[model samples]
Target: MKKYCFGVDVGGTTVKVGLFTVEGQLLDKWEIITRTENNGENILFDICESLEAKLDEKSIDLDEVKGIGIGLPGPVLDDGTVLQCVNLGWGKFNVSEKMSEMFHGIEVKAGNDANVAALGEAWKGGGKNFDDIVMVTLGTGVGGGVILEGKILTGHNGAAGEIGHMHVEDGEELNCNCGGCGCLEQYASATGVVRLANRYIAKNSESTKMTEFGEDITAKDVFDLAKEGDKGAVAVVEQMSTYLGKAMASIATVVNPQAFIIGGGVSKAGQYLIDAIADVYVKYAFPACREAKIALAELGNDAGIYGAAALIV
Candidate 1:
């Protein structure tokens, strides 16, 4: 007689699923590889099969499931159609409709991954106490989510919290996957950090600890070297922080959320990254906005599933 819901976070390489109680307690979780080669339709079949196996193994009845929520990597239209998923090669698919059919009429809700992550943080992670929060994921590319008055803010085109695509530099061309240049993502994301580091090394080859790693270095390697007091690494970190802070400042001017929660792999850089970025963020922000609290995301990699669960809760 216990009520439960399933939260599915669909990524390019993996699909993470979490079983949660109606009250938001995560009871069990699992993941499966997402095979997109057979077309997007096969992905749903694999997920349905995986979910059935997991539920059977746990002796959970399908009747007890209240709903299924999904967090997708691309933009979802207002009418429950997915516009496109560049990573998944899915375009204009009816995700929610397909999911409901797969689950035999169970209720289903779908949203962008960043928005779900923000909702997850608001429900149980870093933004637990605040009704207004902005969550930023600084990974391969930057992604953002906005929660206002306890609701996810999806704009007219369902692309509301796309802070990464915000233009930071005017008339300065830098290639972005969104087909634009000078995007904030190009400077503030982990990919951006590596790009900046590589550029620095290309120009200052003899003056950097990056020279030790040859041509193939990563953002983590840069952070490690920075911790070791490498001058070049330190410079890269500072520059990265400056750009990140600048982006935060711009975000603050618009949304002015109560808190900014930073997540994703790069966030593991810890206080070194946070403190440095905050130092510059305060300098660039407006008087009242500068007081906004900055914090690290508590959920780690599981944030997506938790966030998806939040949609139902």
Candidate 2:
């Protein structure tokens, strides 16, 4: 390992960049617009150029940097090959190799964004001080990363921690983007909470403060109303928590992590969401693993950069 490193997180809208000490301390961070035009041919070029400018601005030479670690918003094979990333207009290619070549053989490592985020939490966020932990990102869709013995379990197809796609509701008919039905993502994600609340009011004709929000209802709305003792909203929150907890429990039977770190926009609900999920997790968790703690992720948007830096750390 070297003394300094560069961490880059590629997203659809922008690319997040970070300068870090090999000791795992972030020194500085910044972002640049991601031009997805022309098949995103400029994406890597932009990142490389941005690094050059950043290094020059800091009066640092490229020789001082150990390597570049990047997290991509897509499935990344063990060889750092990206299958595809619709948001970034990326297709199949060995990202690590290409990046290393662009950087004049300094070094480069790449991984799935969610998995890297898990590595981030494990390294310096909520999962810090624990060697085995899993990170669940509850965004528009659910994303997961499993870390055991302080390493990510990328799995045979680089899809081990696809916890959102885990089968939870077998009877549901809605298809997940992954071409599956009754996925945990459908009921456990932020969008799932709103969908559940709407379903409850529709199926039971229950009066909820939620109805007042109409099309404006959100997962936060459901949790807020639930906290205020709204029956319909509480039920919806509980339902989402139940499925989420159950999914975690099932995950434990395999990886048996010491803790679960919850992140993403929905996690803003804080303790309320963690407690709700933990309540149901106990029922489904293996006896030995039932005590696994659920906690909020400490790193937010910065998690990607932190985890990316960790790849080279």
Candidate 3:
């Protein structure tokens, strides 16, 4: 007898859905525009309808499907309750129960999107072969997910891997969008890189491509210039790595994963980024844990879908 599963990654713009065999082979995947109007009321219905259509198109029996796994853009409790999804316009609610009811009692498991992505990486990406993994996603904002011994540490409120909010600096009183000061996100995210670059530019009018890009500069541009040995961009990347390395070092003390898998858009900078971060991590890490590895995530956008699908298994 063959088995199948469905994975859903609910995002602000679109909901990614994947169909996979129970053995972790992805059969098909598609996307649907997330209708977030009216507090995301249509999101769940949209997912179920999409899955139903896929099943009909594939001529697959509903009984052969084990369950549906979903990764939401918010904190999800073990009971499938979502505390809130700011991007999806959702308030506190039980996502798993509603999804299960929508799918006619099919088992539904839910988790935070970043956490789910971490699980995907652990299973098949950079963290493969390592049961304990910590994933840091450096996109528009920094996100983190922790998987220890093949299990996600969701914490009491499902906020265990929220590494972006870690307070790294003490004198930064301007406050972050999360209403905190000196957060790791403020210094290590894509936007954060631009901020660091501008400060460096202001301090020294160095001849580099980063300064030429003006305020429109991006993290990629900085890294690109750094790869060419540009002094200013190298400084910016070094600074960003400093904060991220320190944060990961602190995380290593508790989560103590075998590897720190770096993902997200910023990670596109490639090996130099990993080298920079690893250099600083080694300096701040506990003496006994200095050997923990740092590597880039293999799956790009598909990690969340794979992870959400894994939730059912």
TM-score for each of the candidates: 0.94, 0.97, 0.98
Best by lDDT: 3
Name the 10 consecutive residues with the lowest summed lDDT in model 2.
Answer: 201-210
Q: Give the winner by lDDT: 2 or 3.
A: 3
Candidate-wise lDDT, in order: 0.85, 0.90, 0.92
lDDT of 2 by residue, 90-163 (tens): 88999999988987788899999999999988999999988899899999999999988877789888998999
lDDT ranking of the models: 3, 2, 1
After superposing candidate 2 on the true structure, give the runs of residues whose Cα lies further than 4 Å from its correct spot. Answer: none
Model 2 whole-model lDDT (C-alpha atoms): 0.90
Clash totals, every prediction: 0, 0, 0
Write one digit per residue (lDDT tens) for candidate 1, span 1-313: 5488888999999999999998889999999998888456678888889888888998889898888888999887655678888777788878888889988888788889988888898888988888799998889898999989767888888899998898877755668988989887887788887887888888888987898887678788888889888888899899888877888888889989899888888888888888888999999998989988888899887888888887776
Overall local distance difference test of candidate 1: 0.85
**What is residue 203's positional error in candidate 1, in angstroms?**
2.8
